[model samples]
Target chain A: MARLPPSSGPASPAPAPVACSPHGRFGPYGGRYVPETLVEPLEELTAAWLAARSDLAFQAELSDLLANYAGRPTPLYFARRWTQQAGGARVYLKREDLLHTGAHKINNCLGQALLARRMGKQRLIAETGAGQHGVATATVAALLGLECVVYMGREDMARQALNVARMRLLGAEVRGVAAGSQTLKDAINEAMRDWVTDCQRSHYLLGSALGPHPYPAMVREFHACIGREARAQILQAEGRLPAEVIACVGGGSNAIGIFSGFLADAGVRLTGVEAGGRGPQLGEHAARFAGGSPGVLQGTFSYILQDAAGQIAATHSVSAGLDYAAIGPEHAALRDEGRAEYVACGDADALAACRFLATTEGIIPALESAHAVAEARRRAPRHGADAAIIVNISGRGDKDMEILSRELGLGGAADSPVD
Target chain B: MPSDSRAHSSSPAATPAAAGFAPFFARARAAGRPALIPYITAGDPTLEASRAIALALAEAGADIIELGIPFSDPVADGPVIQRASERALRQGVTLEHVLALAAEIRRRSPVGLLLFGYVNPFLRLGWGRFAQAAAAAGVQGVLATDLIPEEAAEYRQALAQRGLEPVFLAAPTSPDARLAAIAAASRGFLYAVSRTGVTGAREQVPPGARDLVARIRRHTTLPIALGFGLSTATQVEEVGRFADGAVVGTALVAAVHAAVQRDGPGAAAPAAAKFLRSLRG
Candidate 1:
């Protein structure tokens, strides 16, 4: 526990760093490492971050964007049918997927767009996987009148065609990243390199809670407002917090957001579910928590799945969102603190959960989110009928249905095989 | 991060070598004088001179020595420190050699020694095991230039679990609250980066350093050690009036570089060691 300064009277000590920037290390990782061209923007970001956390105007504008633009206070729906189907445990979902841009990705993008505008930056650049964050960035960029460029792996652009179309329609210049492994990580590398080149006109709207200092901290702060509001709303609606809080850990922004609200509350069990591609034994899992050690990459140290020589190891997951070799640094610290437990769910399990939730709760979850669903399903039986689990329904699965169907041997078409 | 260049033993505090820290601090308290920390890159040339310089710094009245863990790029450093880093890198000094030299120093000196480097070396060595080894090697503390305290909590925890101090840098640019935050998480002295630029001696110290020192004092009772500037005894004396300690880096490295140039590899050690000892006066 951090030693809190004795408050003058009962006043709460200026809100202690929580999540991302908490302790100023993204969990215990994240720092600035881009080229000199980006230094001023980063310095501005650090300054803005210090100011925005306390500035009422910044908070109010962000709040307004969340309400009017992003459709936040997204429903906390009670999954009654799914609850009974999943071993009699009650389940509730904080439906972030229902928000604008079809996922919680907008929460961070909107805030970053606003920050970019405030900094007088006219161009917004980002890297995407499954194009969820790209679509979100493009959506916000259009809304904010900022020129947007999104770097996505060629493979991802091909697979997530609809999202690519959505981004183009939203006025973003989508670039197919051709370097490295040609995946999300590769896109990030390219985007960072671009930011290094044109940081003056562009702001790299990071999609998740990872990367160097201000980013991990900044992204987490924007996302944590989700948990803060959800926690209060859940308490008001359900009379108390849930026994267990679960979120899929792709870059870990959403999970960290929800989990930060409960860090000081020792009783709330936080579970972060990573992608368990085939299984742990297959050596292809995106479960950094399960199979990583402390290593430096992209300028910070955290639990990175790296080879003996410090090269980033390849990561795999059925969910493009979960296919990251390293998680956000704060998640790494949380894992170390024993405050949160990290688990993994495989391709079949996540897809099955998506199908199960669609049929039982009428909610088709993103593949990344279905991993949490799978985890909750596994734990619900052990905890019994009274257990309450809250899952951050981080995104909608509309984009993933094609891949899911093809992989599940249901054919790539929307029509059922029987039909 | 400088941490990548210095190969610290995983548990620096548990090491019998660090048994010297408590006594050193005790002695400082008795002497009513702040510690002087002089930083130098190891092996500006070959092995022999590096050894001589280490002994000279100890003999020159430096209460603690901060060893530079040289890497190819020292981003947080300015031209002087960068040149020094380049010199060391040119000589092909790996972190392992620095650690072995630190072990040699443990055998020779009673002064407190801290390894300063970027995070790469520690990450390469693996943090947990390195902590244990650093402690055993008699190294007292670690200040990783690039290991932001927020991202270093696990390593800090691991180091703490093993009783080593993960000394953190508190820069003039850091927010007041963050200064306190870093101070709170830090063990040993708080390294105050004198300005926004990298490690080097400046002709004029930043004007607000006294206020920064006062501000840090409010948040942490830990000794405030000023670095990134002080090169001479006069500069040290000036900073010593407001701060508890002084760190000199570029001047030491520049001296080593000059010595290497003048006397070749053979003369570098004595020349570098002699320059460091002069600062103690």
Candidate 2:
């Protein structure tokens, strides 16, 4: 070992001050791996969160906003027609699509936006994929009267044009990032750079549970209403818990939310369906657990689609929301511990399921949500006729109408599976 | 050679790493000026061109040369360095290639060598493997742009085994407690970001950088290198009055890029040499 320099004193300087951001792990998953510029802000945020989590005023204000503004307590509807056609298991659709802005993203948006305000940050910044989170964040920013900026990939901007317009209409500036693969991952990189530049005045309102510590758990708690409502509603509807709980995993927010409730129930199996864009190829899919290795990307250490050399790999998905390289660290932990089973549904299958759900139940599921539907269809037969599966329809299909029409070649109602 | 595995972890107290950077900084201090450290992404134009640029910068009075190991996603960098990484990656540059380049530079120059980039690729190459390879290549220190001190214990141990200094960045936003922790974890010079932003060239030296360096002084005596938005000889001279070193990353990378575009690959090394000499003068 190298000898100590004379100018430097003490072998150790008062212990590596435990005053920094928490390790916040999920079996070697979550931890702060950001630049030094963000450490103080993260510590400040953690302290503020610790205070807010206990304060009755903070709780009441957040509850009021979720109920009155964002439309919480979304319904759990039984998809009887679709279940009958799929065969074995009964299916219940947790209608997060029914929430304001037409996606479950509003749930976390409202919670974090309130937390950012409590931290005394006046400006809110976010990174988006399919623009669902951008819209949700923009909507809440408008509600709270905070300045909002959203970074989106130029490619995502072109694909998810309607949501882009919605974010703009909500008075948030949409910054187009054209770096790297020009997708969700690059958008996040750009957002972090933006956050690093002005972290004191701005709060990086990460849209998913996939970032550093507090975010994975914080975003999970914000959307826990999905699991809470589903748990009680399923018991009332089916007289018992679901045989299986399913949701799409991009950053794995919705899946983790619904899975959180059933996690304690050993009898209820939880399955997270990843977007298998084309197939199991490196650039073909965004299936982290399916094809990725554990590594650090953005802020969290988790399974990311990276090359052998460790450079972040290109990812493709029919659903822009699911076109990301990494999965949430918590999901990585759950998969490792075998508490939650993770699987993937190809683009063709996700699209087919979207068409199938729309034709059978008259519900146009977003392409992201359809991954869960497709997985449910594949596994439903194994669950038997008496068994029930709950698919969290994370968003409505309105935002994906253009892609659906283009992919399905116009009149999708008469498609083979829908036929 | 370190035959003992996890030997450093036996102590909760970290070994202050200023030892790793002492000799290099001593030489600069003897010269009565802050060390001129010019950063260039390895294989920016090509591996061969970068070797030429590194040698040229070292000859032009760079006390240390930071060879940026390009990452596909460089969140801590501005457009210039990001474009540098993009150009380097397009040349099929990897951590392995950068190590090889370091070995080549070590053969020709006695200048201080530091590997600068994100940590994922280093970890991808395996921490143990990277430590061995980098030390063998004559790289004295490594700075992971995103690996802060809070989560650097295991990383520090891995580097300490190979006697390679693990450099850490201290931001202006870091509290006193955080700065202390950073000082303890860091082995080489502490990279004090002049601004709370990504690396790039700006019009003026940030006012808070000197204060940040002062706070860092309270923690340890490691030489502080002011990074982020440093450009021009005037700013470098002004920074030299306070800190031990001034890093020119984005400005240097931009200069190399501009030279390559304006006069092709052959002009890159000479233009880089001229740029560093101008900063020192």
Q: A272-353, model 2: which lDDT tens digit per residue?
A: 9999999999999999998999899998899999999999999999999999999998899899989899999999999999
Chain B TM, every candidate:
0.88, 0.92
lDDT of each residue in B260-281, candidate 2, tens digit only: 9999998899999999989977
Distance from true location, Cα of B42 in model 1, Å: 23
True contacts kept of 2: 0.90
- How many Å off is the CA of A148 in candidate 2? 0.8
Report the number of the highest-lDDT candidate.
2
Superposition error at B128 for model 1 (Å): 12
Which 10-residue span in candidate 1 chain B carries the lowest summed lDDT? B1-10
Q: Which ten residues in a row have the lowest lDDT in candidate 2 chain B?
A: B1-10
